[model samples]
Target: MTADSGILVLAGTPIGDVADAPPRLAVELASADVVAAEDTRRLRRLTQALGVQTSGRVVSYFEGNEAARTPELADALEAGSRVLLVTDAGMPSVSDPGYRLVAAAVERGVRVTAVPGPSAVLTALAVSGLPVDRFCFEGFLPRKAGERRSRLADVAAERRTLVYFEAPHRLDDTLAAMAEVFGAGRRAAVCRELTKTYEEVRRGGLGELAEWAAEGVRGEITVVVEGAPEQTVVLDAGEMVRRVRVREEAGERRKEAIAAVAAEAGLPKREVFDAVVAAKNAERSGA
Candidate 1:
């Protein structure tokens, strides 16, 4: 907060259209003592588009060199230099670089501020036709098939709308995984090339989207999926046993089935296990 201590400004750039750049962004770009960008080439294009020239030292601060560069930026801040951090798009550090620099700045007791601008997550959610009342930004799914499926399974029962960023090439695989884990019938929207020419928002069930994506999709992609429908799960022992059996019939091991059912029903695994055991004993005795 002292005049001798510099401040870190996190500036948000356009996700697609260059004009979405905020007026304040230009001001910060022009006046910052140092400008850190995710991509120097992209930053040049942006500055040219905005008709503004950065007067300060501009350096790259991407994932590749973020760790090494953060301390340097922090040192500049401590020396009372105005540091502006801008990513390739959107705010720095949403799923991009800048988190490390921001943390370093904070740790050094430096002031931090931001120039809010366009966000793909918000833009996709607005047009996705899915419930946005409460939602979670999942960033991106794992690239590996098994890891991605496991990640999806972790949130299969999430009731809040889900949003994810994905590469065009991986769209089909990601959507297919979603269909398998979140259910083929689950509603979703695929927003592509947002805020740019040829922008498109495709809304449908996960299965349908997966099919469409299989044919090929291009450009930046954002997916918004409807949350799991609320279920009136009876907590009785009979209901618990029935749920476990259903999962077991679907080829899940008994232990996995019990754990999954317990998670879905918001009950302890031990409770579901006990119910299943009790039901099996009763059935055996009755037979």
Candidate 2:
């Protein structure tokens, strides 16, 4: 690990419109000692559009080469070289290759910073018309349908807005899977090619979005879905205990049964489990 190295800047690039590029982006591109770009050609075009000339050493740093290049980039940072990392679009390492290098640089005591710019996560969430006060960004789900559904099912009861990025080819399937797991009535917004000329954001229920994508979608996709609403129930402690015991007797694990009973009773798992244990003790005394 190198010491007292220069700063590692994780700069965000525009996802679509060139004019969306922040003023500081060009300056950083021009001044950094080394530019690790996901696509050097894209960086070249970006700098060209911004009318900035980069004299820095520009090298490819993408998924394929990120592992190999992280060490080199860290070394450059340790050597007091200003290494600016840029991805094709959005913040580097959000769902991109810069995380490895960023982690490496930080571990080596390199100063790490970012030029916060465009983000598909924030952009989609903002325009999705969903509850943005609290949200979670889930980069990309597994490509397989079964795995995707299982992943989404894990968050089916989440109360925070959910955000995800998907490629066009898999957009339809992903939306369908979301509909199945999160419910067809779940509200969501599909943002396509954000900030570009033909950019489109379709806001509707999961079922509608799935149908729309079935007609074929294009460009980068960002999907934001509204969170589940809170449930209300007034079941007594004895009933809660009996429910968990019933499920547990039916081959479900005690932990899972407890969670199921909690969800059914509209109470926290801990609260429900405590009640269940108390009920069990009372029943044992009676027996």
Candidate 3:
């Protein structure tokens, strides 16, 4: 907070286009006392592209060495050095390496700031033609089929638009899983190679997208999925009790059945529980 205090700058790099780099990024890159990059080679290429030469020491700070390098960067910051962190693409710590350094710097009272620039998440959402008013960035899904499906199931009922980053090779499988879990009729958009040559955005139902990806998709991929539709059906107490009893009869525990029925009815779990309880009490009184 003081004039002499060191600062940690999390610089956002272009996802695909170098020209999109912010002007402050070049200044920070050249003047920082230390530059910690996810990939030194990619940093070199970026500096060359921006026509800027780093006046400070450059160190590799990637997933493989993030833990080991964070403290070193924190030390530099504590010593009144201006440290700049840049990932291979997008903002640092966004499915990239920079979170540890930021946390370390913050814990040490070192200032942390960012140079805002292009973001693939925002870019894809902007172009996806989906509702962006309320959205969440899921980052990436788990690679394993079961884990991935489980992850999808967690948000199967999310009403806010969802965004995700996925690798090229796994696009087909991911899309297929999404289709199976999110429903084939669910609308989605797959953005590939944003701001670069061969950039493409395919929009369709999950089923159609899965088929398209089955043929193979190349380049960086971002997927935007439409949220679950608003529940409109009004379930009376009797209906709620009936649904829970059906699930319970199908072998689900009472608690889980009530929760599932509540979720499907868009009602509080307590409401469904009360309904079931009332129904049982009424039946016993009639007996």
Q: Using TM-score as the measure, which candidate wins?
A: 1
RMSD to the hidden true structure, all candidates:
3.5, 4.0, 3.6
Model 3, 1-287: lDDT tens per residue?
55677999999999998999999999999999999998999999999999999999999999999999888888889889999999999999999899898889889888999999899999999999999999999998999987787677667668899999999999999999888767788999999999998899999999999999999889999999999778765899989988888988898678767766665665666888898899999999994
CA lDDT scores, all candidates in order: 0.90, 0.86, 0.89
Instruction: Report the Cα lDDT for residue 250, model 1.
Output: 92
Clashing pairs in 1: none
Give the TM-score of each candidate.
0.88, 0.83, 0.85
Residue runs of model 2 more than 4 Å from their true location after superposition: 1-4, 233-287
**Best candidate according to lDDT:** 1
Kindly list the per-residue Cα lDDT of model 1 for residues 1-287, writing each as its tens digit. Answer: 56799999999999999989999999999999999999999999999999999999999999999999899999999999999999999989999998888888888899999999999999999999999999999999999987787678667778899999999999999999999877788999999999999999999999999999999999999999998788656578888888888888999778767766765675556788898888889999995
- Model 2, range 1-287, lDDT digits (tens) per residue? 35556989989899999888888899999999999999999988999899999988999999899888888888888889999989999999899888898788778888888898999999998888999999999989999766676577556667899999999989999999888767788899999989998989999999999998999988989999988767756778878888888888998667767765665554667787798788878889995
* Candidate 2 TM-score versus the reference: 0.83
lDDT for position 191 in model 1:
99
- Clashing pairs in model 2, backbone N/Cα/C closer than 3 A: none
Supply the TM-score for candidate 1: 0.88
> In candidate 3, which residue pairs get closer than 3 Å at backbone N, Cα or C atoms, i.e. clash?
none
